[model samples]
Structure formats: structure tokens, C-alpha cells
Target: MATSIFFFVLLFTTVLSRTTPDEASRTKTLDITSSIQKILNPFSVKTFNSFKQEENTVSSSSLLSFQLHSRVAVRGTSHKDYNSLTLARLQRDSTRVKSLQTKVDLVVQGIGKSDLKPMESEFQAEKIEGPIISGTSQGSGEYFSRIGVGHPPSQVYMVLDTGSDVNWIQCAPCADCYQQADPIFEPAASSSYSPLNCNTQQCKSLDVSECRNNTCLYEVSYGDGSYTVGDFVTESITFGGSSSVEKVAIGCGHNNEGLFVGAAGLLGLGGGKLSFPSQINATSFSYCLVDRDSDSTSTLEFNGKTSPDAVTAPLVRNSKLDTFYYLDLTGISVAGNAISVSPLAFKVSDNGDGGVIVDSGTAVTRLQTDVYNTLRDEFVKGTRHLTSTNGVALFDTCYNLKSMKSVEVPTVSFRFSNGKELPLPAKNYLIPVDSSGTFCFAFAPTSSSLSIIGNVQQQGTRVSFDLANSLIGFSPNKC
Candidate 1:
């Protein structure tokens, strides 16, 4: 009797040691079965099908706001089925991540070189157009905003990209152009349109340019062999009837080809000197990405009001690549238990080799291989009671939750250098990958040294970029 009682006590102690009160409090009940259905057809429903022209752009005091929508939601591309569309989106996501990696590699290589003329000398060696550091495009940009392009303000959908610096649009008399939802912008009809001479300061600011018939010509090439070449011009870009920024330097692409379909062009929101935010002298910007399964629209605001409830982290600058919003991620926790990971995994080198970037374009979050392994292991251990299954695509950690109506999940949070933690929503991390109720961890491993905090993990969170103050803030459940 004594021996049996001792064994029972020992078993209880082992179980108690596995879960402390602090850790137990971090767990939340998740409706896994129901949540799985929402993500299976992520692109099936859109927040809004048609744009309300009058309400497209709204300015309140100093803030210039625009209605943001997912690319697929804006009626650009037609997919045969939801599964196929979801698969295609995932494929594009992978390609975009690879292309972003290449851009980072090139930026690092160009460091210490002539910042003003870095690409001029190397352009001849590589047959690609523009500087490699100008950034790549692959029709992978996720969010888009509608804005007026001409005097009467022809409404057009422009992809919102923080990774790119040059704003461009598909113009008329095109040698080649990808199919888009809106009719190509007719430069001849817009009285506010004017070509920039090769000698203009704006033309000279381009990473790579050529003088043709005294008009400045610009070209941007992508890692996937996509290219857009056209005349560089300045036009009056209208936000609303009362608000308009004139002579905004923009690319009028006559020859363009790529995976870019649905949207008219891209609005560059990078930290570079040529990006739209910089050109307008905007002090800050903020965006709240709505959940893919949600039918609600979100706002993308410039010079916007600050979020009082947001937890901010200092934005670390990578001198080699100032376009990306790099941050120091000190650690991560699963159910209040810190995952064992080397700080060096998230360190940004002087030359910008390895670091973490919060990108609006990428769909899935990627971490350094070692760090991701530890995170995956920790999460799996916490969720052992649930049945494990084979992962889908980029996700190696997955589970079959078809039989369960609801399950308690370990809450995940990211600890930044400022001691502020960004807690993730349950649906954001454990995403549905298929219709069979197979859910997988949304985060993936990147072989490259750079790690990306993608949109999947940022859902329902208001991410603010205060460029003037050099800070990025995360306010949860704002979308």
C-alpha cells in the first residue's frame, strides 16, 4: 500500500511539473473545427466588390486615408475554384519570399559602394533593368488601395507595397501590358499629366534611367524575369476632391509583363527617398490588415493618428537596405514559456545580412531555420493532446482536428527589444490549409538569414510605422 501510494504521488508531481499555474493561465479555448472552415476558402469572399468612388479616399485633419482591400477581393483575377485559388496564392507567396530574399542579398552586396551610383556601373554586367536594389515585383503584393490618377480622378487599384520604392501604372500605347481590372490609364486624356525631362532631379533620382528623345525612361526588373519599362513622368495624383498632390513622380509603364494582374499598378511605400510617403513628406503611416476570412474593410492611413494602446518596438535600420522595416526580436514564448533560441538568429549584421523585417507583402511569417525549429518543437509539445498529422506545403507542424469541436491552445507572443510583447490571435498562428479540417502552423522556416513577419501573423492587428520617430507599434484586435 505504501509503495503504490508513493508511485501515485510521483506521477502527480511529474504532471504538475509539466504545467505550472502561470503557463496554464496562458492557454485559451480555441474553436478549431469552426475556425478551420473560414481559411479553407480565403479568397472566396471579399470585403467589398465595388468601390464607392466618393468614399474611396478620406482625409481627416492631417491624415490621408484610403480603403485597403486584398488583391483577389478587388475583382482582378478569376480562379476556377477556391482550392485552386488558395494553392495559387500560396505559390505566389513562396515566389515572393524568394524574390525578397534575393533583394536583401543584393542590397547587402551593394553596401559600402557608391550609394548614389551603385547600380549604374553594374547595369551593363547584368542584363536586368534598373538597379537590383530597386526591389522585385511578382504580382505577389497582397493589399491594394483605390485612388484617383488624373484630374477627374480616374479610380484605379494600386497595390500597397512597403518593399518597393517606385510608384508605377500601366499606361496607354503599350508595347506589352498585363491584363488589369481597370482600363489602362490614358495619359492623353489627363491634362495634369506631363513627362519629366531626363535632366529633371526626379529623373536623375531613379536607380537606373536612360534618356530617349529627351524624355526620361525607367525600367524595373523582377527576380522572376518580370519587367516593366516605360517613360518616367509626373502627374497630379488626387486623393479626393479637396485633397490632391500634384507633380507626384510616377512611372508610366508602356511595356510591362508579369504575374501582376487585377491591379492597375503599384504604390511604393518603402523607406527609400523615392517612395510615395517620402515624396509627400508624410511623417508616419499605419495599416490594420483584416483577416482573410473577414468581410470587413480596413484603412491605410498616412500621417495618421497614433494608437494609444499599441505596444511599440524600436525600428532598427539596416544601412544597406533602408527600404525594409527591420526590428530586433529578442525572444518568443509559447504559453508563457520562453522558447530556447539564440539571439544571434535574429541579429542584423552591419552590412544587413541577417535580420527580421515586417513586410506587408508576404503571406506567411518566416523565421531563421534554427529559431523556427525550436518554436515548432515547443508548440508541438504544448499541443500534444491533439492528434498530429502531416503538414502542408511550407508548414511542417500540423494536426488533424476534424473530430474536435474545440481545443485549448497555448497562446503565442513575440517579445521585442523594448520589453513589449505582441500577442498573436489563435487563428493567426494555427491556420487551415485544406478543406478536410487539416490545420497547420502558419509560420515557416527560411533558409536565408533574413526573417519576415508576414501578413498571416498580423491579421486583426493595427501595425503602425512612425518613420519620423523610427518606431513600429502593434495594437491587437484593431481590424
Candidate 2:
């Protein structure tokens, strides 16, 4: 009885020591005592429905806008419940990261030797088609946007990708197509649809193409073996009722397959000339993603809104892989203390072999192996007062908070070469991975030379890509 009492007293004293007034004030902390139900809400498949909310409140003449939906925030054909779907999503996220790394490797090796062109001689054996962005597809993109296609525009959901170039859709006469929520687009029904001739400049722009009865036929093969093949055509692509781009290049896919069963096709928001934003001649674009657990939808704007006081960072261009938006991430800090990783870990090599990119399609932030470990170790040390639990999925550090109503966690921030600091919200990093009140660190390590700052880290921040100025800006808490 005496021993038990003494042990209890010691434990109480230790806990109190960490929470004293002075110590608490010095530490940058986060309160995570909310209901487990709120934390697990995003994982529940049923939480999101099939309601098509009107994204644009004003005419597209002012700004081209579309509501962006996170993968789990949109109702789809999948029937998996919360736990199963959550696991599936994480597995798919891993697949997406691997494919991204593979694509980067291929791009660096192919273009590093020369200027901007991939080594066609090497890829001929693999039969890789499309541009440098044509590495692979796992249907692992994270966001969706509903858009109007063709003359009398038919509304369809398109997966948004900041890493791709060509805009494509699964058209009628699909020789093969996965299940989708919307009807397949029919070229015959649109008066504005025009197939490009094999001799056109647009046809010649594709990395690989074929001539079929004088028509331009294109094929894009992904790393996972998924592919889309059809005619390259021009159509009237509408944003809202008031604005439309005429003769926009689009891939009318007659045969398409892979994990993209929920959406009609993909909309490329990349930096290449063939990307949707580039095709439309937009100077810039911006988006503010809501929290994964929030029910609200955010808008993707073209030449539209942005915070006046957004901190800006110069957008670096990798001549080898110009399709991606590269950022010079200098360092990272936990609770205002910088990690011990070398700055070279985040640098883009002169040969374009290694670089950090801000990608909309990637879900979790990935860092160099050494950088990630240092950050994770520092975070763990800062939260030593919290109860530790087994890791979840790709996240190695986790906390069990089943008993606590709330707990304080260390704050994390990212620093850029321009001396701009992007301080993240607590919910963005310490994300709930399950209903058991288990929260995991959302960052992960990658052996690949490429590093990506994913959407999770960008949540609640207004991220703007200023192509004209060659800059990227971050406006915090603007979602």
C-alpha cells in the first residue's frame, strides 16, 4: 500500500511539472481534446453524399471557379465502410507516392542528359506515351472538380492533377472503361467537338502519336499499366455559364482503365503548355483547401482571388521536369527549433535529380529519409508527455488519446529559401487516423530524391500559383 501511494505521488508530480505556468507558456502547444467522432468524421464514407452543390456564385466571366472535393469528401461507387476505406485510401496513397518517385526518376534520367526532352530511344522499349507527366496512373489523385464539357456542356466530375499536362475525358464508344458516376461523354452530341487532323501542330506536340485515317490518335500509358487511347480533339470547355474556352485541346478517350472509376476523367493543372491552366491563358490560379474533416467545399480559381498579404516564394523551374511546380524548401522546425538535416536534402540538384515540389495530388508530405527522421524524432521528444501508441499505416509516430479530453502538442512550421515561414495548424499535422482516438504524425520519409509537400500540409492555407511572376504564395488560415 505504501509503495503504490508513493508511485502515484511521483507520477502526479511529473505530470504537474510539465504543465506548470512557465513551462506551458514557453512551449508552442496544440489542444486536441475534441470528440473522437469529430476526428473520425472524414473517414466515414457516408458522411459525404452525392449532392451537387453550385460552386460558382457569380459569372465565370469574372473568374473561372469550380468546387474542389477531396477523394473521401465525394460520394462514389465504393461500398467500403470507414475502417476498410481508410486503410484502402492509405494503401493507395503509398502507391501514388511510389509512382510519383518512379516518374521523377524517369524524368531526371531521360532529360538530365539533354535539355527538356525525354530519352525517346530508351522509352521506345517501354512503349511509354504522352509527355514527361506520362509516368503512371493509380487513380490516386486526391481532389475532384465538376466541370462542363463540349458545346452544350455536360457536367462531369474530373480528377484535378497539378502534376499532369493533358486534359482528358472518357468519351462514348469506350472500348474499355471503369465504372463512373456520370454518363460517358459523346462527341457526336456536341456541335463544337472537332477532331484534330494528323498534320496539326497540336498533334505533333504529343510525345508519341499515331495517324489513323488522317486523324490524330494519342495514347497515354501509366506506370501501373493503366492507359487511355483515343483521338485528340478540340472542344468548347466551359467553366461556368458565362465563360468558356473555345478549341481547347482534349483527349477523347475511347478506351480507359485504372483506379479512376469514380470520376469521368482528369483535368491537368500542371505548368506545361498543354495543361488546362496554360491552354486557357490564365496568368495565375489559387485554391484554399478546407480541413479534411470539414463539410465545406473550396473553389479553384483562375486569375481570380488571392490574399493581398500572402507570403511569396520564388517558383523554381526544373528544365528536366517543367510540368511540376518546384519550391525551394530550405528547412523545417518543430516548436520553433530547426531540425538537424542538411539543407541539401531539400535542394534541387543542378542535374535536376533532386527537388522539392508542391503537389496538389499527393496527400501526405514526403521528405528525404534523413530529414523526416530528424523531424519525427524532434516531434516525439516535444510530445513526450503524451501517451504513445503503435504506428498506423505510413505514419510511424502515433498517440493514444482515448482517455484524455484534450492534450497539448508541439507546433510545426516549414521554411522556404525566400525566408518565408509557413506555420501549420495543429489539425493539419496531428491527424486522426482511426475512431479509437489515435492520432498519427502525417509526415513520412522517402528514399527517392524527390520530395513533395502534399495537400495535408496545405490545408486551410490559400495557395496561389503566379505563373506570370514565377512565384507561389501562402496565405495562412484563409480557407
Candidate 3:
């Protein structure tokens, strides 16, 4: 499986680098037009044009709320080959999970060695670059949001990530760049794009920085081998359609390499100082992801109010892994039956490892090996009467739905330490593998100490991150 995974990675790398300029330009234009249509359909021509033309006059207070749909929904508009799409998505998701596991392992190792030496030195030796704004890799099946950057804002689509802290976009004068579905942003054209000098406070905030001819140079590498090296700059950023914030910190990536197909870069929503939420002074942000199959668009809003009926959980904060949103998962239940897993299994260790995190960049839920075994065994017992089938590479529990007229799937719930419980629907756990009646468990076991609640389990739910109060809220079917 590892060999096959690497093969796909090599193939994707070749394809990305071999794309002709004409092909890339054509795809870029088509994707931009498609994205515009998706976002503009709900408004009148007069209203849409007015918002774009009068963007500068829009006040910060008036621009407080904006919404964006998932990239998956946006891509569905242009996907002509549906038969191959599902398989491709699954393959990419598998690769993403593997990459996340590698990251968890690296974090654990770095923390364990912190007492012996500086963590920064250990990370550098491993080629694990610090946080810089880069796009979410394609296999994650994540969502993208449109944001306008620079003066006289140039609109660019970027992956919306809560696990990252730096906002970045592909910039012109690139040493090496990947082919994106949108036009690369030219910093020279924007009157407001000013590079930060190395001595400035903003440049000093970066985890990894270098002084290059007085300009601040930054580089960030992901666990999946995707990297972005660029200059740090401040510019205006517009969210949704009307809300614009001035003098925002962002990475103008001149050199980038990754599997970011449709996105020009990433919009980081993490809690760090460099994150979009922190920079914009947003009290809270919320998103409601629609079902994967639904053609209906979902919403990602900044400075959005929490629902009155939403359940709240205390967010765990680890200074060592500040870029991720951590949550304390006390227990899990299947069909009202409690699984006996130790609370310590979900706790972060003293070395700053082993904890449950809510990540928007991962496609499927990942659990520690022992916890997953217990859950999988219990699940198998509950559905023992059904005819089982051979497992997929990562998914061990697959059932042939053709043998039964109806499937009875148990409800799975996650109990948090804050007394809040999230009861997930069957679709969140049992995902369709193909056009045939084959369904597989969406949860996978990881060798690493960390666990993740991925976007699949977040479907049809409104997840709100209140950074000011350090609380996480969830309201089902609120989209």
C-alpha cells in the first residue's frame, strides 16, 4: 500500500510540473469564471457589480460577515468524469491521512527531545519547516474560500484551514510554481503590496525567517512534502463580498510546490497571531459544511454568532502545537453502548503529544490504534448478521450493501469533557465507496499518539470556534 501511495504521489508530481502554460491558463480562466458564477448567482447583476466596484468604500463594520462555499461543491460544477472522480477523491483522502500520521509522529518526537535540545534545531534537522501560508494538499478533500488581497483587491481562491496559521497566495516572479486553477497574483500590480523588512515586528513573528537583501524571506513545509517559500507582506484582504480589512499580514509566495489543484493558496484560520482570525480581530468564526453529495452550497462565515441551541465544549490549548485546535474527547459510544477506552488515551502527554484535534484539512476521522480496535470490534459485533466484504487499503470494515434491502447502522457519539456530546449520523461513519452497493467505515487507525476528527464527521454540522472564550460549539443540520 505504501509503495502504491508513493507511486501516485510521483505521478501527480509529474503531471503538475508537466502542465503546459496554455493548458494552465485555459484551466485557470474556466475555474475563475465557474467560481464567479457560483458566488454571484444568488445576487443580481447590479448588486454584484456594485459590490466589486465600491469595495473600497465598504466600511470594516459593514464587512464583518461573509460566507464561502466548499471547493468540492465548486469543483462538481466542472467535473465531467464522475465515474473516476469518486475513486480519485478516496485515493487522495488516503494519502492525506498518511501524511497527517507522519506529522503526528514528528511532533511527538520533537517534543520528547525538547528537554535534550532546542525544538527548533530538531525540527530543522528533520527538514520540518515552520508555519508559512501554503494551500491544503488536494487529497484532503477540503473546502476553499474566495478572498481578495492587496489594494484594488485581486480575488483569489484559497483552502480554508483551521490547522494552519499563515495566510498566503501564489505571487508573480516565481522561481518555481505549481499550476493553479486561478491566475497567479502579481504583487507589482497591487499598490498596497509592500514587503516587510527583516527588522520589523511582523517579520520577527515568523517561525522561520531569513534576511534577503533587507526583505524578510520565509519558508514553510508541510508533512506531505508540500512547501512554500516567499516574502512576507501586508495588504488589504476582502472577505465574502463586501467586508474588507486593511493592512493585513500575508505571504506573497514566489516559490511554491504542492498538490493544490484549484486553489491559489490557503486562508489560515488557526488561533496563532499570524492567522486570519487573529489578524482580523474576529471574536468567533463558524462554518456549516453541506453533505458531500448535495449540490446545495454551504457557508463559512467570519465573526458569526453562535447558535443559541449549539452545544459547547472547552477547547484544549497546547503551546507546543499551537497551530491546531485541540479538544478533550472523554469517551465514544456506538448505538448507545459505551466503549471502554481510557481517558488517558485521549489526553495529551507531558511531552506535548497524544491528543484529539478537530481538523478541517483531514477527510476521515483517525483514532489511536487501541481505541480504534475497540470501536471496530464493537461495530463488527453490532452488525454481525450482515455479509462482510474485503477491506479497502485503510478502511477495514466494508459491507456489501447489495445483500440487504436496508442497512441498520448504529449512531456514533463523541463525548467531550465539557459535558457536550456529538451524535453523528450514519452517513458520517459509513461512506459509499463506489457506484456499487459497497460501503466502508470512514474511521481509520493511526500508529501515532494523536487522534483527529476530520471533515467527514463534521458534515451537516455548524462548527463554531470562539477563540476569545476558548470554546468550540456544534449544531447539527444548521446549514
Candidate 4:
């Protein structure tokens, strides 16, 4: 009990900074579907009018905000025909998407009141490495160079995604019809770039149509509604630094539609493509991120598995499954109390995509109906007697946020795929809403997925996505 209580206080620390209006909005919008719109409105000029047009755009906030409110939230995977403009990964995909959102909301609500400082500090390296890479395409505006350069080199801004398997970019002479990002990946001029023919081992792995010329074909959708379709290519990509990787199989998007601004391509970081490292003459994928350009040198860790000090936090390493980091959940806790959640079987559905996805791109954690309700109940029972928000129509959860107890926040711990349990800041998990009079923790009126572990929950935590080992690892740090 004492240990639990200690964690309770530790988790509640972020709330100390929540006195700002930003937090007030997050407290309300956490469970609501338009969280990113509400959270980033102050910073961005874009209206974020609809779900489909929202995902592909770069946010004034981090990429995290852009990923949270996707078209998927509005529709399910069944609507795949809708395109990013309509068929996006439905704010709820595979019961798992819902769980992820719920998890993020709960943690935000719980940790909004924590005592920790905002973890926006930075450290960078000259060259980026690993699966992280900058997106590139024909029309994608100006590419922000970490070390500069790539300008007019047919620079393509690529989408860095964890939810996909194919690493693809926009290409020229595509009959499929696509808006360019920054000039297409020119096959003729790119001395190092080459397409994979249908007969190769790589093309056969897609498991769908026959690999005609060693080219594996694929298409991917996002929650906010953006999609790309094209053939795979075996090419060489260079990072800003000295490292370069060759023969990396990537998708050359031949067809794309809807809200594809600057037409940047995608950086596939899921288990499958990211797991295989580049051979002798090439370096694998990597990135150098910094909130402020004036910040210190941001470091780069190859494969982030052995080296724990990759980011601000020590990464917890877990192996990859195909192309995803499957973080296992040993148990789910509410109100600082642990719950008996079955492995893979979400209380809401027999099919568990139940484990948490340590996505650095997602803004919140999506949770299952049962898990969300249990945690909400704990918040209602423990906090200022209620949680509420001003905008009731767009989002849910009840008012009484003022009276909500500031102390004893519930700590939500996740057991990683490697048998390690990691506890996140409680406020980073819950959301508040207001009704006619009573205030209660209410689930998003539209939520239907099991869970998604977003970037917010990953703050200060280093996540190691090891495709080779088939696991992901994370470690907490003082953000």
C-alpha cells in the first residue's frame, strides 16, 4: 500500500503544471474525438475541419497531435474504400485503436496534475540512424534539414509511421495519379535507386498477389485519413550524416489521393521492413529530432536495443513481430489498484490487439471499453468527486474537474513484451467531461477500439523497436 501510494503521488506530479489553459482544454478534449484540433488550435492556423484532411499534415505541435484524431476514429477498417478523405483507419480500428485512445486519455487526465517538468529538452547528433527517416515526395514543401542539404536533390518528405509495413515514397511516371511532394523519386537520375523485380524473395513476402518483377505492392491508411499505394523498390537512401543504407526495400507510391499536402512519402518503421538492417555498404534508417534548433546535439542509437540512452529516457527494448513492436501487458491498474486483465483478450473483445503499441507518433493511449470504464470509475471515486469539461458536444467526461482530488492519482502500468512493467504518469491516461449536473469519467461517445499507446504516454520514455529480435523496449527518464 505504501509503495502504491508513493507511485500515486509520483504519477500525479504533472498536474502541478496543468494550471494553464492548454491543460484545461486537454482535460476536456482527452476523451473527445477532436483532441488534436482542440489541443493544437492555439498553435496552428489550420482549421482541421475534418478527420480525413487532418492526419497527413504536419502539426505545429509534434507529429503526435497529427496522429491522434484520424479518420479511423470516424470510421472502422471496414471503410477502407473511403480513402484518407473518408476511409482512414477509423478513429477506432480493431478494438485495439480504441483501447489505445482510452489509455492516452486516462493517462493525460491522471498525469495532467503531475509535478514533472515538460520534457521538451533536446540532444542531437550530426547523422541520424535506425528506422527513423525524413519523408520525401514530389510536392512536400521545403524539407527541414537537420544538418542541412538534400535541397533540390529531389528531396522527398516521407511519413514516419509505425502502423505500416511497407517503406514507400512518391515516384515519377506513376499512371495511378498522385499529387507530388518534392519531385518524385526519379528512377533515371537516382544512380543508387533501383526497383525490385517481381521474382525476388522480397516481393514474395507481401503474401498477397504474385510478385511479378520482384516488386511487392501495398497500400496503407491512417486514422486521420491519408493513404498511399505503389510498388516496392530496392534502393539506397542517405541520411544527413555519413551513414547510408543500400538495397532497402521501399514503396514508390504510384497512386495517392486526398489531403496529401506537399506529397511527402512514408517512413515505414513497423516490425517487418525496419527489422532488416542495411548490408555492408549501407547504414539503416535513423533521425535527429530537436524541439529547438539551439538545443544540444541530438544523439542517434542504431537499433536502440543495446544502447539504453537513445532519447531523453532510457528505452525499454522489445523485439518486433513482422513490423510492429508488440509491448505486452502483464496487468492493468486503476486508482493505483491493479486489475486482472487477460493477456491478448481485451475485456471488450475476444480478439486482443490488447497489448499497448508504443507509438511515438500517437498523441494518446486508446483503451478497451472495460478497461476505460474501470479506470474512469476509479477517477470518479477518488478525485474531487467529479471530472468535467466545458465543450460537452464535441467531447465527453463530466465537469467537477475543479473539485477533483489533486492527490493520489492512479498509476497505470504496462508490462512490456519482454516481461517488464512500465508505469506511466496517471494524468496521461484519463479524461474529464461534464453533464447536466453530475460529472463522471465518460468514455468517448464514439470510441470502439481496444487500445493504442500514443506518444504522450511515451514522453520521457525511451522505446526500443527491435524488429530483428521481434520486440520493443522502453525505459523511463526524468522528462
Which TM-score value belongs to model 3?
A: 0.79
Worst 10 residues of 1 by lDDT: 116-125
Instruction: Give model 1's clash tally.
Output: 0
| Model 4 spans > 4 angstroms off | 1-153, 176-181, 207-227, 261-263, 273-301, 305-321, 340-356, 360-362, 385-408, 415-420, 430-450, 466-471, 477-479
lDDT of 2 by residue, 21-60 (tens): 5444434544555645554555455533653544344434
- Report the C-alpha lDDT of model 1 over 1-479, residue by residue, as the tens digit: 99999999999999898877666668767777678666544456443366634356475634477777765556433555444555666777887788889878877777432353332322232344443221134336578788888776778888888878889999999777787767899999999999999899888878778887898888766666666778899887776444788889999988776656467888888888778998999889988888665546788888985689998988988877877888778889998878998878888998779889888888889999999999989998889899999867777898888888888888888899988887787888887766666778899999999999999888889899998998998888765
lDDT of each: 0.78, 0.75, 0.70, 0.40
Root-mean-square deviation of candidate 2: 8.0
lDDT of 4 by residue, 347-448 (tens): 222222234455534444556666666655655555553344453332245554333234343455554434445655443444322112323232332244
At residue 465, candidate 3 shows an lDDT of 89
Q: State the displacement of the C-alpha of residue 160, model 2, in Å, after optimal TM-score superposition.
A: 0.6
Q: What's the count of clashing pairs in each model shown?
A: 0, 2, 1, 139
Candidate 2 TM-score over all chains jointly: 0.86
Candidate 2 — what's its lDDT? 0.75
User: Which has the better lDDT: candidate 1, or candidate 3?
Assistant: 1
Which pairs of residues have clashing backbones in candidate 2? Answer: 33-406, 136-223
User: RMSD to native for every prediction?
Assistant: 5.9, 8.0, 16.3, 14.9
